[model samples]
Target: MAIEVNGKTIETDEEGYLINLAEWNEDIAKILAAEDELSITDNHWEVIKFLRDYYDEYQIAPAVRVLTKAIGKKLGPEKGNSKYLYELFPYGPAKQACRYAGLPKPTGCV
Candidate 1:
C-alpha cells in the first residue's frame, strides 16, 4: 500500500509501516497517525521521536516490554509505564508509536 504525503507517493506495508525508512518525515507521520485516528500532540511526539532515536541506535524496533524499560530510563518512570504509554498510543505503544516513527512492526507484535 501507499500513502501520499506532500504530493509524494510514499510506500507502506499492508499494515501501514513505511516500505522505505528513508521516506519518513513529519508530514508522513501525521498522515499515519491520522489513519489510526490519533491526533499528534507534544506528548505523542515525544514517544515518536524517542522511538525513532531508539531505532537509529539499535537498528531494531523494540518490543513493548523493552520499550517501556528504555523509555523509563530516557524519559522517566512516569512517562515510561504501560499506562502512560498506552494513554499516548492506545493501540499498543511500541507497535503504534513505531509505525508513526516509520519503523517496521516491532518484533513479536501480533
Candidate 2:
C-alpha cells in the first residue's frame, strides 16, 4: 500500500510499515501517526528517535523488553516502563514505534 506524505507517495507493507526506510522523514512519521489516530508529541519523538539511533547502531529492531530497558537506560527511568510506552503507542510500543521510526516489523512481533 501507499501513503501520501508532503505530496509524495510513500510505500508501505500490508501492515502499514514503511517499505523504503530511506523514504522516511518526520513528515512520514506524522502521517503514519495520524493514520493510527495518534497525535505526535515530544514524548513520542523521544522514543522514535531513540529507535532510529538504536537501529543505526545495531541494524535491528529491539523487542518490547529490550526496548524498554534500553529506553530506561537512555531516556530516563520515568519514560522507560511499559505503562509510559503503552500510553504513547497503545498498539504495542516496539511494533508501533518502530513502524513510525521507519524500521521493519521487529523480529518476534506477532
User: Across residues 18-100, which tens digit of lDDT does each residue of candidate 1 receive?
Assistant: 99999889999899889878889999999899999999999999999999999999989999899999999999999899999
Report clash pairs, candidate 1: none
Q: Candidate 2, residue 82: CA error in Å?
A: 0.4
Worst 10 residues of 2 by lDDT: 30-39
* Each prediction's TM-score versus the true structure: 0.97, 0.97
| RMSD of model 2 against the true structure | 0.7
What are the lDDT figures for the candidates, one per model?
Answer: 0.93, 0.94
Model 2 lDDT tens row, 71-94: 999889998899999999999999
